[model samples]
Target: MKLLLFVSLLAAAYAHGDCGGDCLKACRSCTCDLPNDGPSTDDGESPFQIGNKYSGDCKQLICKDHNASLIVDGKIYDRLVCFQGAWHFGYPEFLEEASSAMCLNPGNRTCPDDAEMRYEDDFKCMCKPDFEDMSDVFPDAPEDILPLCTNCGKKKLRITFLIDNSGSMASVIHEIKHFIGQLVKFLKVSETGNNIAVVSSAFSYDVLINWGEQSHDESAIHDAVDSIDADGQSYLATGLEAVKAALVQPTDENTQHKLVVFTDGSIKCGPEALKSLARAANNLEHLKVETFVVATNSRYTTRLHAIANGVEDNVFSISSEEDDEMENLKVAAKLQRRICA
Candidate 1:
């Protein structure tokens, strides 16, 4: 009975020691040094020089001895690691030959012949395996344990303005400029890293502001918006194509993209062409279009809504007689909620 009890306690202790806690998710830096010949002190006479020390969470205190031995303590230890508020020597150390793995941040340091730097966590530098199933999201997991890493991609926002530059829009050009100024101000006040771009639709199309443009210089964008001239025919399809050309799908899996179209008068494209164009635009799963009709004329309202994916909330209209200040305020508020949300 006494022997059985002792064996049970030893097994329990062994099981508890097996918990290595969290492994390091990334590697910061590593170096190796050896001592040189001569009566040199430990200050600068190491044969192999210590490069930058590990600046990651798994920090270590190592001692280089007179015999050019590298270990945690001068001659007694391997590597000292602090785990669970207690220091354990030689238990968990940086993976050997780590340079052969796929290093995420391989700063000028060279790893062993075949080792490479791999992804990081919080414990030690792990190496990429010999073979991995790229389709498997957690391919790095050992057969006994669950996978530790998964990609949680980024989210991005893109805002685009499609404005009409036809002759009839001359009276409201100033109002458009003011609306743009307010929009820029709102973006600045919100402090979200949203992308901004502008497309002018008139006799010929021009992307005055390209996509991925930031809001750093408000004056430059304001000048571009204010410089729009009311001239030529309202070619809505032309402008839409220009916008499509300027757009790029972000590498991340998810994004929020908003395109606001402000146009007056009729589009130059025929019904068949308009229908084709609207279908193509709607097919873009990651992009949503919103229309702001500068006129209440029936000639453009129904057709314009089609371009806006036939969503009523996404379609807004403001006529020449409407109060410009109130209309701008409403539109700006709606935009803030939709784009910045």
Candidate 2:
């Protein structure tokens, strides 16, 4: 009876002002601080609170400071938010909580367990190297019961790279090399064996890009990129088939697979390649993989646009005029996310 009476008194006091007016008993807010977190921005630090915690959506990937960005689907959004003449995301708990959590403590053998802080990004929590602002917070989830949502960060993501390793690619091989190198740098790698599988087919004489490597070590891909020399016919059909096969591996409603084709011209591929692309599209009609084509020149624009996006909803086009090296890397990163499956 004494305990029950004490509990009643505590509840009454809490309602008065202990938790603040309009604050829920759960000590959380239903609305996330807009601009507090999202896809791209610079600083990841902000001083905003709606109820008792963060003021942003957990679905928005958390980044360190405002220097980070977010990759949605296959497109990248940079510096999308502005705050107080600067940029930020969620809050910088590390600097503030790290000390209390003993993360900054030099030799505090025993510390409070509640002091332990979350670094924000899911990949980082798993001890994976930081890249692409991959954190495990389901920001899309409605607030209030947000804690119930699991932000594993990475979802099903499938990406396929179609290349034109013909002689023309030789001229741009260095540029491609730089692009691939930086790709491995900015994109996050899969820690749970979920990564990007690059099924590439080149065109010079016939076509040779698929290594049948369903899932090779991400490390190996950076090395394999060195072998991309120009000399082959543009048989894009063969490449398209390879991508279709890769997309067939995943079996989950969460799967997000994509096929990206990079080519220069239709001189070598001709009608055969077109037929294969069309068939590939038909194959992915109900499958998880959605195809995309990135042709280098206008020669096969019509066919590439047609074949890459059959009946599926999403597709993209990039001009050789604009540097797509980083964009391609983003594609690879998303594909790697799918590969994590």
Candidate 3:
């Protein structure tokens, strides 16, 4: 009877004002103070209560489940919220209980056993990374749950480089060599086994090096690249045709096929055939093509753009106006975003 009466009194106190109305019962020991309540509109919403969790709203991927909540060390926190992908902080209304839950304690090692803090572009943790942002294919429908990345086993990702070795590329071969070296480094860190191949075109075309399968022979790839010297004409169509034919042939469904082409000139060998080959390669369900042109010149851009399956994001036209080092760095950064994201 005494225990029951004590519980009743504690519940009453909890209902009144446990932590000065700033936090839920679970975060009572948290030391951070709430931001200013500011002004409340007639609708009963205020800056202090709504928004202000992160700098702005999350963009890129929407949350699968917004109503989800989690209990950590006896405290409740919002588990899932939608990201509008607008790159701002204008999220729709969230549960009132989620306000204090966003302010996590960095020092406390009391995160839930199943979840880890999510870092955004700002690298701060107001969200959990486990919640995946779905592709924009479904604009209107939101999913009930976000799928988590599985580490069930290692997968294979096949990367093919269609390098331009024309006479005009002599000036930029040094930059290209550095870029490939960096690419090897990036792939080395990936969770999957990566297979690297090189196909170059000049007055003639040749597969400089082929390890047969996805091999971790970084030194071999580097050696093949080192052996390449710019001396022939750019025959882009021939290279694309060869790549398209190879991609359509039988291969493992588990292997992801990616073709990255580096060029600076037009297809001197065949123009019409290049278009057909590019369209065919893009249409291949198993292949993704990303092309980089060394010239910002409109003529070069148009040619590379067409060869990139008409996707602007996949076509990177580096301007000759900038220093070679700077341009290569930019290309490396952009590739990191696409490949690592």
Candidate 4:
């Protein structure tokens, strides 16, 4: 009788062990037979009464029938089973959460192909180096979410400014300067990949700021603009020729080239000079030239419009006689919108 009792006790112990110590109250036939009465702790040894809870890696789990239950928003729904000593979700609806919860730190978080996980005040996915941030254009986007990123290679632009520095432009030089300053601010020239070059059109064409020369420095570009002064005659054709030469230089295939001309409707040479200007402007292979005629008289408007390929949208006229300050601001704002588009 003593030997039989010892063997029975040994069998009970083996059954309890096979149940992974989850059957604290009762282990019947090598299984937990009691509901809401199992080990609540992660170690699987202590008994958990009804309504007891256990904290898992991603979520808090409640004990029910020796299995962990998933509770979301104060309601317990699905059961979580123990696999390899860790609680795993049993339902497909929670799979995404399970995968995301594996990342305990930013370094472990997975990001999209164009982005990478980073930590600032908190863990976030940010755009990679070769990508550009397009946040400003999306004003209605959520504040907490990061903006979408775009490829830098596709959005590159190269802009050249050809300003007429003839003696007739003395009255509007300051306005031109203000316009240039506002444009620089709007373009975020110092922070972006776009390039700005300034060519002065007078008795001769002078390249004040060459392509990629101090291109990223806003203060330097402004200083160059400030140095410009009204002098000599407007050699418009020569200026166009210079701009054509500059645009012909090899650039990235994806780059969009633009020429912005600020003239006071004065050309030194006669009809032949106009023809020369037209030829020079027409021969530009991949350039979009915009003409801004700033003058008090409408004498040169027709000629300048012709030079702009008769596109009224391409030619902007600003009258120096009416509200100089307001007109410059309004025209500058318009140019900003067009260029940024």
Candidate 5:
């Protein structure tokens, strides 16, 4: 019985010794050289102590009974044994590579080669401009898993705005500008890789901004909008043709096109001219250019709907009461959803 007791004690000693000298050394030194701020303890202690945990960095460390353990994204680094006072797998080169790897959330998955990890509200893996997200295909997969992505070859978007700068629009021009400004903020034009153009439609059409001219310059785009002086008759056909020409400019074959028209309707043109506008709008449909219209006047809802390929939801109506800042904000939000969808 004494021999049996002695053997059991020897096994206990071996189990404790398994923690190794490096782990004990790491615990004693308590060095955590992570990218973010210096190490912090969960209990708000200045110096780390046993039962203390260092978190919020690339890697996590916890000092336990005379030993230290490395963790990442709630997963213990079982294979990474402590060296000196740092966590390392094997060689110094391997340690460097591991340190550089990004820690993504949902499931702490590594981003794909063609993707990059971005932080907005949380960490997200965004596919490169030329790649498409394939996460929808794996609906049953855990949310923590990294998204699957594939190269899309070429991805380009061209959006054109046709604003009716007619004599009648002068009353609500400020509301139109507000909507445009809010849309620009939501779109993040510079980051989305989209080219933007603006056309002012009066008796004649004016290309206020050309595609790819102010694509990345939000301030310049706003300046162009501010320069709009509402006057002349509303020539819808002229603006439609101008938009068509701008969208047809040479671009990638896979380029997606969008057209947004801000008008109070009140087309001063005759029936033949209106028919011509309808035909031009139809031509854009044939080219697969998504179209939307915002009617500043509720009375012109029918006219705006007709311009929007006869799609009722594609036309947004802003009543006189709804021209205020708060109301225009709601309208812009709805418009953003449709355009993005």
Candidate 6:
């Protein structure tokens, strides 16, 4: 019995040591310095196809896409990384071959070719960009995690203006109106398939596709927005959910659904409601939803961060306590990109 207990504890220790955590679900960054140029297979039986990483603007940290060495804590290690479906990092195929190994340092210090194991040398690590799935509802992500794209990919964008229409929003409604127009104009000409729509609800906003598929009518959306007079309590969640439901979803060959919620009032929803909203948004593909929260409440910033994820830049606070609501409107107008053509 004593022997069995000892063995059991040993096994448990080994198992605990292997804990990799949850990052293995979709992607994982390798810390080992092994050199192998291969594509990372999805967590499936078939292996991922191997491909070259240096294509166009795509880059691996350092001059090379893969195969870089670094000295960390007096130990040499190689690294591999997977970003955007490409395996940019991996093991090197050969050992040191030069008569003198080059130090990554500016001096390019030379060491014996056989000294791959001799000196404590420092080398640079290769870095590659990370690829993230877009959201259908407002997204919440860290600033550095946002993917870089010179041109919009196959993303379908539908930004809805959800202005707080309760008594608290009356001062900001006109500004919200101008903000919508500016957003619409910026998106219409992008050829990025960026679509614009509007909706209003008591204490929050809703989708105005009142006329069905053709709901993108300019005057109709604007008039419908104007029709909503400020009144009622701030039922922020209801309107957000309503807008989420209204987002177009024929993800067959074209179109993507990205929701942008604009609000200037406090939220009345609790934690559970917020989680449900996040879960609903997380399950959609081809959608990268985000919120551009505009308000004066610093206390509510945390809540906004929770809802928006790492999209903190999306949050804008109007600092002037004495400025008229029109000034806020001007701010909103400029918040939306302006395009003359």
Which structure among the candidates has the greatest lDDT? 5
On residues 1-341, what C-alpha lDDT tens digit does candidate 4 reach at each position?
Answer: 64564465455444444332334333343222222322245455433231234311212233333433333222233443222223334443232122211111233445545566654445566767866655564444344434345453333467778888999999988877877875665555643576778889889988888766576578878988999999898887788788777654555556677677887777766788788877776765335444443343457876677556566676776666535655554555455445545
State the RMSD for candidate 5: 14.7
Worst 10 residues of 5 by lDDT: 50-59
Model 1 alpha-carbon drift over 4 Å, by segment: 1-156, 189-192, 212-215, 249-254, 283-299, 321-323
Candidate 2 wrongly placed segments (more than 4 Å): 1-153, 156-158, 184-186, 203-216, 246-255, 267-273, 310-341
State how far residue 232 of model 2 sits from its true place (Å): 1.6
lDDT of 1 by residue, 1-341 (tens): 64564464345334433232232222111121122222334354422322115322233333334233232222223334333333334433222221111102223433221223332331222223532221233243233222222111111456677788887777877777776675555554212445667789877788887653333356767777888988887767667767766653432345456677766546666777677657645654334443443333446667777766666666655544445565554455445444443
Q: Give the TM-score of candidate 3.
A: 0.54
Q: Every model's Cα RMSD, please?
A: 20.0, 14.7, 13.3, 16.7, 14.7, 18.1
In model 3, which runs have C-alpha deviations exceeding 4 angstroms? 1-155, 189-192, 246-248, 269-298, 319-327
Candidate 1 or 2, higher TM-score?
1
lDDT of 2 by residue, 1-341 (tens): 64564464345434433333433233332222333323222243342222223442222223343323332222223212222222222222211111010011122222121122123332111222222232232233222211221112344244445565766666666665555554444333444423455555554222223333433356665666666677766565666665555445555676566555556545455566566767766676557566655444556556766665643223333334335544554443433333332
How far residue 126's Cα lies from its native spot in candidate 6, in Å, is 36
- For all candidates in order, the CA lDDT equals 0.49, 0.42, 0.49, 0.57, 0.62, 0.43
Model 3: per-residue Cα lDDT at residue 314: 72
Model 3 per-residue lDDT tens digits across residues 48-97: 23122342222111222232223222243333221221111222332122
Give all TM-scores, in the order shown: 0.47, 0.44, 0.54, 0.52, 0.54, 0.43
**Which candidate model has the greater TM-score, 2 or 5?**
5
Looking at model 3, which ten-residue stretch has the lowest summed lDDT?
144-153
Clashes (backbone N, CA, C under 3 Å), per candidate, total 26, 38, 11, 0, 2, 20
Tens-place lDDT digits, model 6, residues 80-167: 2333333332332221211111112223433221113322443322112221122211133222222111112223355556666776
After aligning candidate 2 to the native by TM-score, how far in Å is the CA of 245 from where it should be?
Answer: 3.6
Off by over 4 Å in 6: 1-156, 189-193, 203-206, 210-216, 248-253, 269-287, 318-341
